[model samples]
Target: MKYGSTSAPIQLARGQAMSSVKPWRPDEPAATIHAEGAWLQGAFISKIFYGIIIVLSWQCLSLLWRQTTRSNYKTKMSFLAIVFAIFSFSTLHSGYDMKAIQLGFVENRNFPGGPSAYATLSRSDTPGNIACILMQWLCDALLIWRFVMIYRGCVAPMWLLAATPITVYLGSIVIGILFTIKKLTSGSGVRRT
Candidate 1:
């Protein structure tokens, strides 16, 4: 089966049952119909399921913040912001994926003088993937922070150790964001950086 830019192949998940069905043809509908209706249905259902989980997690964190009085306000606020930022970025990324499918696969592919249905990968279509990348960078930094706190116990040289990784990580983040914006605006879906 094929979706948006029927030229590309749809990579089914592992354990997916393969049908002898041919890929979408130019003469056929822009949106390819697949035999795996159940899987397609489940995909949408999972999106909703995860969305609910995010809301629940947000509520629990908010409640915890309100109930805890022993924690330093700055520390608590900093952690809370990181958590919020990760979730917000992930949600934004999902939204971008949805929009890519709608515009590239469903609508544009069906119309003449329009974009390919599957012309671009969702992540590279625009700067939207930066949300996901930033989330990843933040999570990695948090892990590094935790390690530094445990092993070094906030010793003076600990700052030196943390500084190197932190600096490198931030530099990479800047490069990633710039690369995404450049490729997106240049109308290229692939990134060399």
Candidate 2:
């Protein structure tokens, strides 16, 4: 067998030879296969983490539901609503991700740029992305609300103290909206040709 020089040693400007530093070649089939394997591994890991989160969220939901009664009903109901919203969005996001993964790896495995590239590059999962954005906003707003409630009277010039989170919250909303609009109008986030 002839061992051709498919990968020759590269000489650097610093009088050094790099014979082992392989450059990334996305067009290569081997590289695409490697990327697909890496993406699948990451997806599996995410599923595991999502499973853990589901268990924790279920536990929290049950505890909160058990605590709700006629007394303090209003406050408990508000907390329950926030928690339920978070859970719903998280579930929706996970479901979307799973669907995208299946479509990219199974249904469209021969898509133009390969399955990994198609899965990673496509912004077709806009619903999932938006759900993630909304979930984050909800969590952040909840935190800000808690902060304000705890320090409403303890801090003088409460407005100044609370301004940071409020401003940040609003800024995030604007950014998230802009991002969603851009994604929606950008046409499929991948190239077919």
Candidate 3:
């Protein structure tokens, strides 16, 4: 099946069944239909994994909170902020995904090119995508901070050593911003502009 602006063949697995999926009209391209089906399936799997991560994260956050003390207030608070930011971003991402899923499957199931296509056209998932990107940037920044801390005294020229990662991180931010802009501007992936 073809999806978006791309036309490529896709086939169901040998034993796979389409009983759960309603048939698309004959006028719609098979590729677009199949792509939507695939996205729906992937969304289901993503939710399952997201649930597991949320559980583990909450447990870790609780443990951290319990272990925090007055002496380590600064460090602990910083960590807490980072963790909370991550949690918030991820929650936003997941919530948006669920919202889109509901709209696609329940509210707009009959939308042209299917729910997946509708998602692309409407750009309804942009917030989720932004959250995901922000979460990634936060994680990367944390890693870089940890790296600098670890190599602080040992490195003869700390600034030089840190320069590469900082540059790369900045580059990534610019790229991400450009990508978001592109996504926001593009009309729809289902139809070529």
Candidate 4:
């Protein structure tokens, strides 16, 4: 072994001598693997989100079902139960798609499209993204309804306060529509070598 040889290839930059190569890799992976990379593929986190939504819906329904002693509130209570269940089911459907992508696409093909295909909104999972937006819209509408219930009428202040969220809700819907259109327009990713 040559000790302290000047021919050891020291790098020179801007008339200054520099030694050692800069590291081309991080000290650690960008994301720490949790539950065996489940988080990266979105399977673990999606399941947890679904579980939390289910638990909260179940609790709300339990309370509603137990307290309904009148026919008027009966319809309202049933409506809530239905809406919550529908939204929760929609969320679960998205999670199901995530799991399928993780298993069938990523793991099966050895992550051919990389991890981005598994997590981000792809061509197939567009409906899942729409469902999430719809659910969020419904939740916001329900909150506005709660305020209406409290004010006993659609007063000016209530409407004034609702302007911002309603505008945001509409904006999100427009964005979702635009995204869907863009996705459809950019179809057929198949390539020939």
TM-score for all models, in order of appearance: 0.56, 0.75, 0.74, 0.61
Question: Model 1 clash pairs?
Answer: 4-117, 4-118, 5-117, 5-118, 104-117
lDDT of 1 by residue, 1-193 (tens): 3357533433443223354554334554434444223434654775795597599658857975986566577777777788888778778777765665456545555544333424443333354577768867887888887878776855568777788778888887888878777656654343212
Compared with the true structure, model 1 gives a TM-score of 0.56
Residue range 70-159, candidate 3, lDDT tens digits = 999888888888888888888899999888788876887777767766777766778898998998899889999998999998847988
- Candidate 3: TM-score? 0.74
Model 1 score (lDDT) = 0.63
lDDT of 2: 0.80
lDDT of each structure?
0.63, 0.80, 0.80, 0.60
Task: Compose the digit string of candidate 2's lDDT tens values, residues 45-99.
Answer: 9788778778877888899889989998898889888888888888888888887
Question: How far is 80's C-alpha from truth in model 1 (Å)?
Answer: 1.5
Which candidate would rank higher by lDDT, 1 or 4? Answer: 1
Give me the runs in candidate 3 sitting further than 4 Å from their true place: 1-30, 188-193
Query: The CA-based lDDT of model 3 is what?
Result: 0.80
Candidate 4, 51-83: lDDT as tens digits: 777787777777777767776686767667666
Clashing pairs in 2: none
